[model samples]
Target: MSSFTYHSLPGFGEQCCEEYGFSDACIIGDRIIVTGQTGMNPITLQTSADIGEQVAQAFENINNLIVHALGKEGHPAHHEGKSGWEHVVKLHAYFVGLSSIRDQARALMVRSIKQWCPNHQPLFTMVGIESLPFPEHHVELEVFVQARMVRFVTNESAS
Candidate 1:
């Protein structure tokens, strides 16, 4: 069996899971898989009560997770690594109260995609969830990126 490595950021608290559970970031060879991210306030470590804010924060958290994962492999953060929408062969977005704010959630996701992956577009699926693991969580996003080794490059180096 191929062994996978998991990494975590300092001062980010404990991994969401224990035992068979891994950290927020995981690496399988050159590919990095980031777990779902939520719109939680960094300071208090609490989910945002507002849906829009939660949506925005979730993307930011995803960005941070990507950056951190890359950094673990000796790459710089925000590096246009081999992962983006095009590289992201699969994406899953879960929204709490999705029926109530489906339009707003989509808009926020579009905004985040524009900001994070402006060059590539990935296949995505959005689902309305009755509730998340956490009551405060209004939105959560999980993404899977698949790319070749050559395409991975730091954001600065890409320019």
Candidate 2:
């Protein structure tokens, strides 16, 4: 068996975690993997219809969660000219309506990166889907990052 301690994020209740059958974020050893986060506000649990806002929120969520998990909230120092964003191993950007708004979506994502984590590079895969589980959500971001033990990310839901 693997040797690692586990805990759920603090903001949301245990009921929500159990109902969803997943934690907002989990850490094991030197790695902490967080679930995808969307622009949707937890209070309303409603996703924004605006593509730009959605993209921005996605980037924000990833950035915030990673830092929180590192026990260093806010902007942390970069290591070897590498910021938290650079450590992201994989990014899966899922688009609900691609054929019609592919260009717009791409632009939004690029702009969000510039705004959130400037001059950063990470492997990304863009997937075009007819629709997402949440009908109103236009975009979703799944992030995988390598992190050392410190803190836990507080995320209520993706959107």
Candidate 3:
């Protein structure tokens, strides 16, 4: 059986299931799966009004979760210095006021992706919805990535 690990992000508590019925991230074998992440402040645990800021934070949180999971398994934190697998194979960006701020949100998201995944590029879809699952949330992002596992070794270490 492959070993699977669960990681609850710093800002998100262990009670994710009780509240959201989902874990922040889950590892199955060498692959890691991350759920939808929003732009909520870690300290206050509240969503922000600025879409750009929120989008940036959401990416950061996803990266942190991926790193933490890989570290637990003795693997490198990033795949080619990018988070959420390889090039975010698939992405769904949801905005509360998508109609009004679609362009702005897309601009911010592209910038954030460039900052996070400089090498890998993934297919992305943007959607504007009337409301998100959470009322306070203005934007949410769902990403799917596939990355090859990397092992670290020292010159003196045995194969």
Candidate 4:
């Protein structure tokens, strides 16, 4: 049987999974899949009016999910409380206004990657869309990660 780890962060992560019946992030062997993350605040459940702010929040949310999925003490990928961005191999971003906010979004996205994954570079894709699921959300992000697992997980323990 294949090994897998499913995780949902605190706050909105739990609520979303419970209501939608999907996990926020899941690990299959050494590959990690993270769901699309918006700029909405987890606690407030609100997206900001500013596009820059929304872009930042989206990256933050993505990082939070990755960290929870890989940074826990017992997780095979855990690494000294570091940001899980290190394990990311690819990033996909969706923007509400690709043409209008292209420059701003590009700058912000570059800045975020530089800050979060200083030691490695990750593939990235950005595209514009007419709108997002939430009216106020200007950006959404999803990530894929490849990390080596040092330990084995039993089916019973995974549960």
Candidate 5:
């Protein structure tokens, strides 16, 4: 029944979500879900045309969101493993031109995953799409996080 409010990125506000009716990130207990992220820069609010860089930036954006959700509020801190990137347990990747760029995309994703989780690999599903919501965005990543959920129960409740 307990849930954390959505943590939206910059440039996305009430109007944007009201139109789309979606939030960038939401957390329920320990589980977190982040909307597909593009290579948009949080500061500049721009997406790179380069696919490789776009993939990297998209992952970076996911990392930023994880840190915001897992770490202490108002303070920058690394998550349990690999600076908050490990919290990302699963990913759904969308590519604009899959047939032409599958190899490049796979390579970059593998390299990035290694850097994030050296000991384990998160399950990934890559999909080819004609286009993305944002025209300039070449790659979009949907992130899912599952952490240990703990609830405090008083003696009365336990009894």
Candidate 6:
């Protein structure tokens, strides 16, 4: 049959599911392909002007997606060994005015990645963009993760 299975976490990417019919992430076999995440708060829908804040929020958003995809709670520090961000294998970050904030974004991203994936380094890509879906958003991050093990919920009702 088909390997693709799509999901949208409760508050994170539900709008896209309800309005646009796009899921936050898709699971194909052991891999989770997540949509690009912005700094905009899912509850407030507001994005911070500070690039650091935006970058931090974006990473948090990505982590939340990964956590939900793995069918686990969002807390407790870490999941069963090699879960959450630890499963991430690739990351692509899009930044507006990358030249202006390259150093700051680099430092922040590097620190976060090192903290999250201390044992392995995921392939990373950073590119410049003129604008994002929202004006206030300064950076967007998308991740590709390989789950060491996953319990797939075949239907939304089951999830």
Residue runs of model 2 more than 4 Å from their true location after superposition: 1-15, 72-86, 148-159
lDDT of 3 by residue, 67-136 (tens): 7666666665353454553435667788887888867887898898778777656678889889876787
**Best by TM-score, which number?**
4
Considering lDDT, where higher is better, how would the candidates rank from best to worst?
4, 6, 5, 3, 1, 2
| Candidate 3: count of backbone clashes, pairs at least 3 residues apart or interchain | 0
Which predicted model would earn the best lDDT?
Answer: 4
In candidate 5, the residue pairs with backbone N, CA or C atoms under 3 Å apart (3 or more residues apart, or in different chains) clash, namely: none
Q: Which parts of model 1 have CA positions greater than 4 angstroms off?
A: 11-21, 75-89, 147-159
**Structure candidate 2, residue pairs in collision:** 38-158
Winner of 1 and 2 under lDDT: 1
Pairs with steric clashes in candidate 1: 79-154, 79-155, 80-155, 82-152
Worst 10 residues of 6 by lDDT: 72-81
- For model 2, the local distance difference test gives 0.63
When sorted by TM-score, best at the front, the candidate numbers are: 4, 6, 5, 3, 1, 2
lDDT of each: 0.68, 0.63, 0.70, 0.83, 0.75, 0.81
Per-residue lDDT of candidate 2, residues 16-117 (tens digit) = 577777655565555656676767654456567788878876676666556555553222332333445655766789888788998898887777666655
Q: Count the backbone clashes (under 3 Å) in each candidate.
A: 4, 1, 0, 0, 0, 0
User: Where is model 3 poorest over a 10-residue stretch in terms of lDDT?
Assistant: 78-87
Candidate 6, superposed: residue stretches over 4 Å from native: 72-83, 149-159
Q: lDDT by residue for model 5 over 1-159, one digit each (tens)?
A: 965868766564233577788777787776788888888786677777788889888888888777765653332234344455666678899998899998998998888888776755788899999998778888888888765423459899799
For model 1, how does the per-residue alpha-carbon lDDT over 22-135 read when each residue is reduced to its tens digit?
577677765678777778854468775778788777776766666666666765323655333434555678987778888888888788777767666667799988987778
Error of 1 at 16 (Å): 2.6
Q: What tens-digit string does per-residue lDDT give for candidate 6 at 9-114? A: 7775888799887998887766789999999887678788888888888888888778887674232333564447888889999999898888988898898888
In model 1, the Cα lDDT at residue 90 comes to 55
